[model samples]
Target: MATTAISADTSARPAAWPRALLLIGRVALGLVFVVAAYTKLHFNGAWHFSDYYFFFGMAINSYNMVPFWAVELMGRVLPWFEVALGLALISGIALRWVGIVASVLLLAFIGGMARAYVLGLEIVCGCFGNSEKLGPLTLARDGSLLVLALAVTVGAFLIKKRAERVRAVLAARQETVSS
Candidate 1:
């Protein structure tokens, strides 16, 4: 039951409106990132705060994938990265590249989860500062977000191609009229 706030005029626009679709995709993905970051940054009240970064480190360490030396660094940086991605996606600047990066990150998360599952390590998701044990549901959620990111990429390309065709057609018409 997800409701998109995209404008209703999308259908009325020209066929080369992949940009419109891309915008919708960006906002959707951006929201997920924002919420994830908020959970870490605002977990405890304004005055009292949870050590989300440290907890996240513990959660990630439970997976036993990342090297010991890198765990702390990653835990500290990941939340900030998610916030950046959220802002970038919502801004619609470099939409295609942002979508690509989001997809790649989602893949990495999914990979980590998959490995943990194989090893019987029921680690917390740590995605939204949640301590719930990981399982198939996490995989499905990440997979769905991946699909949205890819859709934005494909849509943007379609818009670019259509714009090119339109430009070519207009140039041809101008040439014929001048002659």
Candidate 2:
């Protein structure tokens, strides 16, 4: 029996560019996190430490959104998380989970910037590092990151879904022939 031809365009050829773009996005986000953590822990000194400490404290003790202990734990752990996620993205392992975690972090950053903007607080986003100023423009700058994180998330999802579909199709064909 003659089998129907599978179109060349239909097969998921391993494209270098998509992987490259995803890697870029992952590294960018990861670098941002690692740098932000480093700056807060080092360069900006007391003020940066104070800012992060208070910010996290509020999230835990005051806001009651994320637990106080959890926020405290993140204060020490976030930078490492960034480093790990960045490495995972660049290494091309578990891309989907990395994308999801990055997305969540970006969303949180956006929310913080938006809150500061609305509250009329003259604060630096402390995104890349501590700065003297922040405003709607800064928030917009962070929004771009949210967009990038989203793109990465979607790309990872698509790749995984396509792989799943291909595997399912192959398995079905095998079953049919065996019976």
Candidate 3:
């Protein structure tokens, strides 16, 4: 009988640079979301929280897409939601699902902005705040965000899959050695 040795090599593992880039992308996207939420919630030197929500609601209403009730609900919920999502992204927690959620949110935002622009509805974007106008710039910015989100999402999944494969290979090698 002949005995063969199985060598453990990490050369087939994913590169470190790609992981670094993914981290950078994730943190950057997270910061953007956090800042956006802050802008929406900030009082701009005012002391009234309701005042901020009122203006935010107006911005949502300008789209003329949803009813007043939905506008009220979204206006009140979205900033906090952004804050939570941003924190999750920054913490690198459940990144795959978070990335998906972020991408979907960005898509919805872009769609709304495109609709408002195409219809020539002059309205505040209500993105960062009630100040930004819905125009080419807003659409472009959101579109870029969507792209970033998608890239991060794809990268995350790829890394996860690679890790799984590496683990499987290692496990099989161990089993062979033991046998």
Candidate 4:
């Protein structure tokens, strides 16, 4: 029995540059989180007792959205969370999910900055270290990060779809050969 041919241009490989770029984006985002976490958790990068908890608490308080009770808690928890997420991204364990999380985190930062800007609050972002004030630059930086993570997520999704297409082509060919 002769089977119909499966034509999908499978001979043409998908461009690898997009996948490489996705890896680059993931690593870059991971590095950002790692550096931020390190700066927040350590004082002056000397591994000494850092004032991050106290200073970060003050920073969060400046945002005015967090209640007094949660301000300190958030300040205390955020750094560790950053570290974990950074490690995960760097490890490339779950690129899609991590990219999504990174994007969400950036969005949160952007929202926070927007809130401060609208409220005319002249507070430091305290992301890496103590900054002069939270202004347009801070928002722009976070917005850039959001864009990066979004690109990573989209790239990963496309790669996945491409892989599925290849598998489908292979399965179809196998069925034809057997028939």
Candidate 5:
């Protein structure tokens, strides 16, 4: 009878491809958010913040799903929030929580778009800016973003677990050797 030995090396570690994929997804999602924020904030050949706000608020109001007060507040705040979230994601900081937040935001956007589509309200999406109309394309894009955010979140947790397991195994081996 032949006995085979299993090597307890880093070869037993988690695969790198999954981490790479996670990084790619994170970066892609981050870029999308940053671009969306930029579009909302940008003014053509001018830097009029109030104009941007008014237009964005109008876009939000066009959905008719929220109160005027809420529209004003969201117009003022949402773009900045998106910028922060996007930068966090790109920097890979606090990825697990960031991913969750990103996913939630995308879900909310999708829900709003869906509602607008169902109600037959031809409104600007207020997503990328006043240019994007609420339609199947907008919904599909948001849905894709939600999927990417979710995958990144799940991958982050899985990677964390794998690292913990690896650490435990290494500690156990060290103790055995000392004994």
Candidate 6:
């Protein structure tokens, strides 16, 4: 058996345009999550930290709908989850899974915010701390983040689908030639 030289073109490039866009979205989402988490972690004072925590408590309790401990846990871990998701997005490892998870998380946040808004709760949103306010404007901002997360999911899946198609075509050609 003789070995044949493979052309350089046979090697895959680092990333194409679609992958680049996906990467950018992932990084941007990750940064936002990280920043939000950072703001919460470093927040101080009676209103900034305490008011946000109290509002979250209200949401989890559903205005006295659920348990108090559950509300506390929800308030405590929410920021950490965002931070973790952001790190995963930035790492680009298991991006497909991460993007999907991030999208779901965003949807959950949107729903919570919407519910609180409908209940006529005066909240800070705490998404970006006291800097940002709640209401239609905040909902729009949350929706925008969700949109980005969904785009990241779609883009990542598209890349994977393209890779699978290319692999299938190459395999089929190889089979036909071998036969």
Model 5 TM: 0.91
What are the clashing pairs of model 4? none
What does candidate 6's lDDT look like per residue over 34-130, in tens digits?
Answer: 9887776565543354445655554455434347787888777787788898999999879899999999988987887898888898766767754
- Which tens-of-lDDT digit does each residue in 1-179 have in candidate 1? 11121222222346434566677788989999988887776655531134666766787788888897789888778888989999998987777788789889998988988888888886787777765668898878888988988887677667767667666656655665578
Which residue runs does candidate 2 get wrong by more than 4 Å? 5-14, 44-74, 168-179
lDDT of 2 by residue, 90-111 (tens): 6667878878888888788677
Model 5 clashing residue pairs (backbone): none
- Each candidate's number of clashing pairs is 0, 0, 0, 0, 0, 0
Q: What is residue 6's positional error in candidate 5, in angstroms?
A: 9.2
What lDDT would each prediction earn against the true structure? 0.76, 0.66, 0.86, 0.81, 0.85, 0.76
TM-score to true structure, per model = 0.81, 0.70, 0.91, 0.89, 0.91, 0.77
lDDT of 5 by residue, 21-63 (tens): 9999999999999999888888565655676778888988888
| TM accuracy, model 2 | 0.70
Query: Can you rank all candidates by TM-score, best first?
Result: 3, 5, 4, 1, 6, 2
Segments in model 5 whose C-alpha atoms lie over 4 Å from true places: 1-10
| Model 6 CA deviation exceeding 4 Å by range | 1-15, 45-66
Model 3, position 122: C-alpha lDDT score: 83
Cα misplacement distance, residue 26 of candidate 3 (Å): 0.8
